[model samples]
Target: LEGLAGELGIADRVSWLGFRRDVPELLAAADLFALASEEEAFPTALLEAMAARRPLIATRVGGVEEIVTPGTGRLVAAGDVEGLVAALSALVSDPESARRQAAAARARVEREFSTAAWLGRLDALYLDALGQRAQAPRVAAGERPA
Candidate 1:
């Protein structure tokens, strides 16, 4: 890939960094995050990018739509290279829009997918379960167990 990058005259534009551990830091340094996967399940990396407040361009697949909604980012049909390129070009050409979208993504992640939000949901579920349990019929004080 490095040789191909050099042959294509894109060696300078592309970094061949491998097995990076500082993903958040890398995303912080990046202008945008691009994912061209044809299929996805959780798309945790996209979430990481959003949490990092980077603009997004990802193929629309699986749970991506649930995360990358209207204002958060741009989505292209999977395998649609032209659409992907167009979206990427648009985001790069319009820095203000990209920044706005990235901000919205970050805000959405914090509001909807943050750890606090998950814990809040868990608390609600437990509260609901406890409420239901309380509603179940109970034997009188001295009655034998049913």
Candidate 2:
């Protein structure tokens, strides 16, 4: 990758920071985030990027669609180089739109996927299960009730 960057005359603009622990800090400093995974299963990086208020350009796969809704981010088909390039170019060319989407992403993460929101959903599920259990026929210890 470094060799390719050097060949492309972009080594000066790129940083090959292989594996660091300060991911949150990195995300906080980014203007935009791109995830070009061929496949993903509930990508936590997408959530982190959204939480960090960075515009996203991710490939359409797995749970990406469930997260990057309209006005939140751009999703292109996996392996579509042209689509990825277009999405990145569009977001970069329109700063205002990028900012808007970033803000919306943060808001959506807070409103729907936050810790509080998750707890609320869990609470509802438990309550519904309890209600169903309560409505079930109770049987005596010694005999079954018809």
Candidate 3:
């Protein structure tokens, strides 16, 4: 990352804070949050950004689309530099829209990704799995469980 920053002539503009414990504080202080991952699976960083009510710009890969909806954030195709640039530029130019999106992002996180929501979903999944197990036909005593 430092090498890339130097190549892009942004070394002075960027700070490389490796593995800090104050992630929430950092996100809270940001005007926007961007995740340029080529691939991801429901990244926790994205959720943390949403929880912090920061406007989000993320790649449309894996479960990202499920989190970053139209009013919540901007999603670009993975590796699409132009799309990412456009999203960031738009947010920078329109603070009202950005703030609205940030609020929406935070609301979505609270609605769908909160601790209570997660626990409820987990409990439901466990119950459904247990019910399915009970409904499955029993194998003979000498057979392996299937």
Cα RMSD for candidates in order: 3.4, 2.1, 3.0
Predicted candidate 3 versus true structure: per-residue lDDT over 13-61, tens digit per residue:
9998989999999997898999999999989999999999999999999
Name the runs in model 3 displaced over 4 angstroms.
126-146
Ranking by TM-score: 2, 1, 3
Best by TM-score: 2
lDDT of 1: 0.94
Tell me the TM-score of each prediction against the true structure. Answer: 0.86, 0.87, 0.83
Q: What does candidate 2 score on TM?
A: 0.87
Please write out the lDDT profile of model 2 over residues 8-72, one tens digit for every residue: 99999999889989999999889899999999999989999999999999999999999999999
Better of 2 and 3 by TM-score: 2
Better candidate by TM-score, 1 or 2: 2
What does candidate 3 score on TM? 0.83
Local distance difference test values of all predictions, in order = 0.94, 0.96, 0.94
